[model samples]
Target: MSGRCKGGKGLGKGGTKRHHKLLCDNIQGITKPATRRVARQREAHLGAHLRGDAWDVAGLTPSHLELIYEEMHGMLQVFLENVIHDTITYSEHAKGKTVTAMDVVYALKHQRHTLYSSGG
Candidate 1:
């Protein structure tokens, strides 16, 4: 049997095993923050890129933003899994043996999301 992994790496059987391990790690957030301070710092750094007028600072407190970010992160984790599963299904049906960019595009379309490309 061909031992290629879903993401197209072709290191044979060991690659397949490693791919599954990586996928599981990602879905389980193996690198996620272990404390509120880390989460807060991440959120603050993300916000630092915004313009001075980008947000109404008086509106949302740091605590509120942290909770919102936490919720958003959880929702995105589930969405990410769904996307991966759909892409795998699409690739398998096409008999391609690997998930390609088009497979991801179609998978997102199946999930009711469209990705736009920018002209260079």
Candidate 2:
């Protein structure tokens, strides 16, 4: 009965139509290249600050160091996601494709500049 329809946000409760629309909207668009580019730049800039000689190049302030570390962590997460995406799209059917920590290490060494330039 209508009395049981306690609708509003979230699951099978109520507002079911709106929830379905929201889900569709979320899935409708492809990820934008510009957005990915911005993410890569942010990561790389933060990375530059976190490197070993950064403090010597630019005096280390405690807060600045913490901020750099936080940015680096976020950038690493984004980079990892890209790596996973690339593997899924390009090598998925190649057989026995596994992404190990070493895979990330190798990818970073070889692909970092290219990925940054192209906005991966």
RMSD of each: 9.7, 15.9
Q: Which stretches of candidate 1 lie over 4 Å from their true place?
A: 1-19, 22-58, 116-120
Error of 1 at 49 (Å): 22
Cα miss at 43, model 1 (Å)? Answer: 18
Identify the leading candidate in terms of TM-score: 1
- Which candidate number maximizes lDDT? 1
Model 1 superposed RMSD (Cα) = 9.7
Model 1 agreement with the true structure over 3-112: per-residue lDDT tens digits: 55556544563343343533443534533344334455556767777535454335887898767656756776788889989999999999786778988998898898
User: Candidate 2: which pairs clash?
Assistant: 7-14
Over the full model, what C-alpha lDDT does candidate 1 score relative to the true structure?
Answer: 0.68
- Please count the clashing residue pairs in each candidate, in the order shown: 0, 1
Supply candidate 1's per-residue lDDT for 89. Answer: 96
